[model samples]
Target chain A: MTDSPPREPRRLTRGEWLVIAAPAAWIALFFLAPFALIVKISLSRPAQARPPYEPVFDLASGVAGLLEKISQLGFDAYRGLAEDTLYLDSYLSSLTTAGIATLVALVAAYPFALAIARAPQKWRPILIGFAVAPFWTSFLIRVYAWIALLKDEGIINHALMSLGVIDAPLPMFATRGAVIVGIVYSYLPFMLLPLYAAIEGQDPSLREAAADLGASPRQVFLRVTLPLSKRGIVAGVLLVFIPAVGEFVIPDLLGGSDTLMIGRSLWNDFFANRDWPAASAAAVALLALLLVPILLYERAQTREGRR
Target chain B: MSARVLRNATLALGFAFLYGPIAILTAMSFNASRLVTVWGGFSTKWYSALVHDERMLQAATISLSAAALSALIATFNGLLAALALARFGAFRGRSLFAGSLYAPLVLPEVVFGLGLLLVFVALDVERGFVTLVLAHAAFTMCFATVMIHAALKDCDPTLEEAAADLGATPLRAFILVTLPLIAPSVVSAYLLAFTLSLDDFVIASFTTGPGATTLPMRIYSQVRLGVSPEVNAISTLLLGFVALILTASALLTRGRAKGGGAG
Candidate 1:
């Protein structure tokens, strides 16, 4: 391979150094260091002490004490996570639930994105604004809003009964279905924005040419439009799905006691069970499970950036 | 055409799905009845109740303070990071710096929250207003950086170079020339960070200690206990505040664009 000519490396000035170093150091301390702690803590034992975990790094006790503490750390949490069906079940269900919700949001958001993208130029901004308006509101409150709408005595039930659609109120709240609804509703904007951007960026002439070439509307859509918007679909799906997989709010509020998600399980393990090691282990596993989607999203992002 | 009808129908249904609950919740905030569902008559009693609710009020104060502090810190740091990424031209460890900066955006809140809490514990730092501000700033800085970076990327670099040619230092060139041009985006980024901090629940829940509960934390607890009209009232107020800020921001950016174009 022919190598490119070597160039002189430009030294960073003081202003450049300040700008680059500040955020890097902050993230290194607060973001990267914490992950290391999580991995370390996950290997330790749960305790009845204030911090609620054993094998603390006591700097004052010197090197011997630190090594002793390190030796005491074990895979007990991961072992427990593997042994317990609850952990595995929660992980599986969280993935499935988030997956289903992503599909539902995609199906619902695609048409919305299409409508906005194809709307009159004057109306495009307004339509897009409306799509994202819900995001300005508090997420917890939005999930809470669903509680008022889905509960037995809530608006949906009252309306159904008033219209004589049903004799008794339907059970909606605290169901897996409600959790799905909450996720889809909350994440619709995430799905819509990317899809709209993708669809809107397309050359309309291509679709017109495809139609002129004897392609049916459906055929043009499936072959041209959908394929063209594949990047958006992947971006949107991962954008919604990754967060939904580890979602703590919707499941805790909208899901029944029977509803199992890794997020809620981690919350319960840490807060309710006071098992720091277990929660850390669960978090580690959740991060591991989500690695593929996160990487895919990064790839899509880089591809988009390159364009 | 049937396709047009289908498209419009989907738009309507999608918007309804998105806004219906919010509308209903806002309406219920004015319900006279104590029961959230049954509307006895039009009233602002719940709003009044929210005003007097000590716990909710205290939480709101803390939330606002933390949001302001965190947004300030995040915006400043994000401004630096944006400059680094956009103007520094592939500095050493740039990819690693960018990775950590963006990583928090997709990292599960539960995971980040747990990690931060553990760190605070390990370091023996008290978890309260300070920790909450630190954690919120850490996560929200990425978003601010993204917004400001987009603005910086679109900026013409010659103006800054011109300032430098006029004998201004690089920092002075940035402050005098580049900063004003991107001021709108900086304000927008600040507002975005503010709202994200205010809206955070899970991370705040983990990082906050006694007496540092946020509005979302309070609302979450109350909602878990069951629905209340007071919660509705508070939520409606928050919704109105956020909408107002967002509208002002939109106008600010739009006004700047128009002014720039006219000039």
Candidate 2:
């Protein structure tokens, strides 16, 4: 009912500039500064006197630390990744686990996601909230809860015993299979949300029209629902799987200490070994490992959205 | 033998699997058994003991402070970034900036956490609450941006434009018109970031000093050594607190919707 405020026609004011600049500069200085530091440290060789000291920062500490030749800044760390059995094995294992988990999550979440989308409108929000309720708690607690459940003498075994399913307490706790189960549980919500979103967005009329044309329910789901939900499927898979690949918590907490995950190995390199350059190199490789799926799925999302 | 019944049973079982552990943990907190997970009889000893636990209280304080500070800063910055990206078209290198915003989400916690540690060590920066806040803010801010951007996407921009044409200044139009529309989303984003910062253990472990141990760090250290009924009590309390807030927010939003105030 009331008229709007008069236009001030303000330019970029000093106060506004200060407010924006401070955060931007702070993010650049610290948030991004570490990334830059790691890059510079990666190029330098690990030396005897002061460890992997960069000549740029030290100025007068050691000239031998300085490698004027760009050639010397070779892929020693990356080469280390290939020849070093530990990095090679860990990277492969992490990738394999993540891939399998993503496939399993997609298969499992697909029907549930469908059921969620097809539920009555009145019940949709409640169901959706239930799906996301687990995320409200401290994620550490959920993963830790699995520790108690999956342990040798834990409730799962105890219950199985009481039911006479097996005579012995199984060694399910620290196996790679348990690790996969934990990964799936931790990340299943991520898969469900996006898949639900995409499925919900799809035109119900398409299915109705197909039904009127004598398409079977299975045929309608396969043709009308599945292909149309590709964006969500891809989005959900990448959301769950990519992070699971580089996951430190699940693999560490639920996984066997001997699981040899790339994340744990990198943690050991930095904290236990205290080799900054080598650790940075390993991280650089990990970043490379992550970029493939990230960029691919991101591009896919953009392209699919345009359609 | 019956596929329909089988699928329905599996659905129910999945729900049980999802919630059963939490229910068990909550019950075990009250169990008289000293050995965690073994039930003997019900007692409130662990809850009573947690009240007098000095270290846990300090850790809880640190965690609350970090979550509050980090969530506040991230919400402000994230709201601004969301407005900028949603309001303005592509800039010289807009995609690069957006990519930078999300890079934290994909980076392994160990990598990001330890990488931050190395940077701090190299610079001779002390490990303290300041560093911890910065680390949590960096990661939680990404989540904040995504949450707010989602709300902004559904908003009608024509209202803002109309206000601007009717003589409202750009900032004033945003404050008076656009802000009202997205305020609930902002609150949700704030809560989401707060929970994320509260839940952080991997990043906090690397960034925090000896005196700045948050709740998650304390729990992790304890769990590594051994499980305690005290931890079960703590977990129950933490879970209940978050669940309560989320429920209240949902109810408030639904009430507003029923009142015909929200679209």
Candidate 3:
């Protein structure tokens, strides 16, 4: 063995500091800055002019002028969300819709994940490939793919009618069911991958022990498997739920006007009404609603890291 | 026996549910007929048509370049963040940095999009390719950080130490030893960021300026107008490209695994 050079003690170096500063600055400017801007914009009033929102603070003005400007930034937009039944309904509907979609995704993915986990060891990679292949495609295109199959004159309807299953094509497109299907379709991988990892990593001997003890496979699964996979279940739930809550593309492409997801409402508030402040306020409100789940996930992750 | 049959059936049905719609799209891409449900004999006319479409071609260019640039920047910065978080012990504001790094993972695209747009507007900066790159980089960086940080955490510190003991400088040891060992993570992080940037619709939709339409934005507009076989052709090509890349990478990883264990 070669003689070793002098081993240096652990210390934070200037080079490391400089390297860290790059990403830190990027995150601050691009991530935190926008969040701060959203809060500021939500407080300001929507304007008729360019950029479409009043400035909350103008440095060109002195301290007294700044105070006046700050006071001018009111809660009109938040009040708008509270006062409008449409906005209130949209919020409520988004929650219910997202919640339902998450449940649907979980139900569908659980068995799929379980099946993959239980599959022959040699086939596991191929099975996972099948599950993840679709995710590699464009998300928008995947939703569009459903449209061709779900439309009145689309493949599903045409095939069903040809088979004399129904006299007229069933109304499948532009409904809540369609929206939920879209969400489930797009998010299935998110749910399945985590659950598969959890299940696959489980101690096989526990199942063997249960089998040796004459416990039914069903009983063993219900008690040993389900409880063991709870962490993955929670992870899959949060992954599906958080994005589903603010989902825009699926509801827009698949759900009818009755869908009323806050994502679509946020889109309309900004693009259609050009109410920047109102849109900002709606986003902030949605973030606030999602904070509980986000915090829970954060805590869960920390706890998982500890484990 | 019935339970075995049931388990197999569940697997079949699950695969069907996942692959059915995608199969329809891929099949339709080859149809000679322009109709949504009808299949006249197979033809490649739409694929040829896609090549001739200027707007679509331009949008594809914008998308490819943007994804490349965004993925590159994100991978670099993310590698740095990963190093800082995983290797460095507790530092002041480390928790805040970590939290902020991860917030983008769960933040709604609409909120982030709207917020970024507002920030750009307030700054009076042009919202175009630069802004798109910035937004994509910011979000994808979080994903990259998670990946590389995990790799770094699992990395054998003793290797780098051994390299230093062999008279390599700290930076040299990192460059020569640690970087090669974690190269797979870096490559995967880049691919992840690239795919995300390529597949992104919402954030790009919010942040893009006129004449800077990405492929997803182009597809979104064409789709909103009506279903066309050309869109199917493009989707097929995109799907085929991604499938090829992923298969190659998967095989590469498998080969590497068999040759030598991952660092």
Candidate 4:
């Protein structure tokens, strides 16, 4: 461990204070405070007025006014969330879609990652760069690219028809399947990079030993390589799954109107419906759903950091 | 040999999958026909149309300025946070600070977007360019911090200690010794934040006011209506811009590596 040696406690200098205080204050004001507002607004009643929520807390109104406002807060938005089948179905569908996308990305990424990892060291960085290059491009464009390929009379259909693969253009665009492809395509690098790192870090000698001990190639992989890369798999899955669950661009651009996703729902509720409270409620619920995976990811990161 | 062939084939297929859509999009941008899939001879009419678009030009201006400003802010804040996390071993509220920094990376943009919009409403801050910059910097700073922090972790601490023992002030040592060493990473972090801001759509949607629409927002609205060759043209240009930046940075790093090797 490169932990700092013990020393007499010393006060931070002005420069040190500046270094710590600026980002902390910025995060507190922007990141932490906004979540607090979300919680407060989620508990507030929707109203037909400017800002669109009732019981607005006013600092000028004193403690008594603040207490009165607090008393007016309730779980009405959350209750609406519970009662609305749209929200429920959207949540479940989002989870299912994201879950499937993560699995597909994993299966697809593992071999590509392994191939890169097993390649000559000189080639690994170039291969990894190619894998990650697409990520640097505009995400919205990447999702939109699927539209060009998947639409009726699009490139895929045109090619398929010409090749006599199908008699007609398939109904590929504006479907849940398209949304899954978009998510998998957009986030494959997230899965690939972590898996590559883990696979590349494994000891070649351990694999040789497994093979020398009469283990078949499959057995060596199942017992040694697969188990060794478990951390990477978990990290990759969480990274892809959590973000995919809240994906808006992919579902919005690629999915049919019937496709229910929490992100799209939240957008409609806030923007189109002008239901701020409901949107906040949905955001809170989405966060709550994601907390487990996020925590797992953090734990994985900390353990890796320790190593 | 068969395994090698299989591995090579898998890699080839993977890269093809990754690049194929982008390649098609770029090709479509050059097609003269209004129809996307049809080949009516190659032309740059879409690019000219994209350039002539008033809304697109305005949105591009907004996107570029916002990305530049936000990238500056994110890089500054992120560098400070990286120093705090990497140098200041333990401190009050360190865990909370760290958590907030990392949270934005994984937290759904919808959550942050809605949250920030609500806070802006509560505070009566107008939703416009400044708000967009603030919101962008807030999230992209997390990415900036992660990149810079990794670079910092890889740095040898003894050099800083040596500087301190040589009677240089901490700030001076950082500026003269540490800053030069981490300059490449800092530049990369800045570029990363810039591109992230440029690429943003959902967060910009929530946080931006009318007349402050970004290029992505413009492209998205157009895309939702249906695919257009003009949108393809703009996307290809954006891809070219990003590719240029990437190539430049790669060369910069390679140059630095060669210089260091010689030294």
Model 2 stretches astray by more than 4 angstroms = A1-23, A45-76, A303-307, B1-11, B252-263
TM-score of chain B of each: 0.96, 0.92, 0.94, 0.96
Q: Give candidate 3's TM-score.
A: 0.95
Error of 2 at B94 (Å): 1.4
Runs with alpha carbons beyond 4 Å of true place in candidate 4:
A1-14, B253-263
Ranking by DockQ: 4, 1, 3, 2
- The residue-by-residue lDDT of candidate 4 on A1-307, one tens digit each, is 1223255335566778978888989998899998999988899888999889885577899999999888877799999999999999999999999999999999999999999998889999889988998898899999999998999988889999999999989999989999999999999999999999999999999999999999998999999999999988999999999999999889999999999999999999999999998999999999999999998888777777757
Task: Please give each candidate's TM-score.
Answer: 0.96, 0.89, 0.95, 0.96
Between candidates 1 and 3, name the one with more favorable TM-score. Answer: 1
Worst 10 residues of 3 chain A by lDDT: A1-10
Clashing pairs in 4: none
The lDDT values for all models are: 0.89, 0.78, 0.88, 0.90
lDDT of 3 at A216: 96
**What class would a CAPRI assessor give candidate 1's docking?**
medium
Interface RMSD of each: 3.3, 7.1, 6.5, 2.9
What TM-score does chain A of each model score against the native chain A? 0.93, 0.85, 0.93, 0.94
* lDDT by residue (tens digit), candidate 1, A150-236: 999888998999999999999999999999999999989999999999999999999999999999999999999999998889899
Q: Least accurate stretch of 10 residues (summed lDDT) in model 1 chain A?
A: A1-10
Q: Tell me how far candidate 4 lies from the true structure as C-alpha RMSD in angstroms.
A: 2.2
Docking class of 4: medium
The most accurate candidate by lDDT is 4
